[model samples]
Target: MKYLVGVLLALIVFNASAQEEGGLKRPDIPGELMVDVGFNVWTSMPGGLERRTWSSKSIGIYYTKRKAFSSKLSFNYGIGLGLEKMSLGDSSTLASAVLDDNGTTSTDDDFVQSVLIVANPESFSKNKLATTYLDIPVEFRFHPLGTEDGEGLFIGAGGIVGLRLNAHTKWKYDNNGETVREKTSGKFNLNSFRYGYQIRAGFRGVHFFYKRYVSDVFKDPFPSGESPVMTTVGINVTGF
Candidate 1:
């Protein structure tokens, strides 16, 4: 991790130094920076998750660098951070601490799914499993009329490599007549590394993106029959 960061930083410094020694240069031919903001939808989920799943949503953003290759072509790449959540079907909150395996499910033939032994399931309005990541993004971009001018249509194809930041469960509920909320932070078997490819396109800096993590969502010893590898599709509203 440190090595990758060091190399990227070194390259950035070298580029900056070269530009300084060469005197002033055109911003368009030099480079452009951007940030991505969008949502995520999980695809190819296995059966185990379906039984307890509701709406799954994610939020993402990235900071990128685009170095022009011509009036219509460039290479875009950079780093950013993001967050995601998968809302389970059951309303019952997790019973265990951070990564404890004691968070037993509440479903039963005799007991209703709406009820729980660990938490008063009826009190909560929402409960979800969430995760975070630190990402490095890369793309090959084409700017139809060049970026030095005003707005233009742009397209890119590439991928990103992300390191898992953290994972947890969060919920908000009414205790008596008051609202109560809590968040548990831990790695619930998520892998340390995630990588995937994507395609991006947009007009005037507003872009849309789609990507799938090449790695699984969890590490070994995960509960059997749960395929949680995630596929994300979202938009990058603007850049700077």
Candidate 2:
């Protein structure tokens, strides 16, 4: 992680130097920068004991450059940063224990002895819960248009990597007939990578897009033994 950060800083410095040496030059070509805002629908793949679904909003900013490397072929390159909110299902487990007879539930007569036992074991109290994430997406796009102004539609598919920025669990539980706020630190996967496919159609500087994830976001043991898929339908403010 440290090495990645160092490399990114070095690239930024190099770009700054290059820009300083050659002023700001706007290309005559057709391309654009985009700002995208959308919502996420998240669900578990294996369908846990309790099916869970949550909604989160995200915003992304990307810079795109489209140029033809050949007479019949052209490619689009883009780098973007996105912010998202994550959430989990709200549920809990309930249990019961027995009480001692000699101390609390004791009876003066020795003829009979009694004990307390548990009954309900599945129950949960609802509360506020959410997670935040930062994602980076780099993709190569293909368009049917040439060097002329934006006229037709385009399709894009790419790989996106993300990091968990912060997470917190909030809930209200009763203790001795009093409600108290409880918070637990959420440990989400620090890094996530997923591939997505997008279909977009639009004219100069505006496009509608529908995208879906093709890979699992969870890594390793997959603690929940399930896969989660995310899909979004949104718009892009760019000329592609």
| TM-score of candidate 2 versus the correct structure, residues matched by position | 0.51
- The models' CA-based lDDT, in order, is 0.61, 0.48
Most lDDT-accurate candidate: 1
Summarize candidate 1's per-residue lDDT along 21-131 as a digit string, tens digits.
548442343334444444455554433333233366656655555566777887777776656777754445432322225655434532321212144645457677777
lDDT of 1: 0.61
- In the range 1-240, model 2's lDDT, one tens digit per residue, is 232345458545655655535484443444466666677664553322232333455556666666555432455556655544443334431111223545353343321221111122232344433444445555444556643433455555555555555544455555566666666554433234555666555543777766676665444323346556667667777632
Best by TM-score: 1
How many angstroms is residue 169 displaced in model 1 relative to the true structure, after the best TM-score fit? 0.9
Instruction: Indicate the worst ten consecutive residues by lDDT in candidate 2.
Output: 111-120
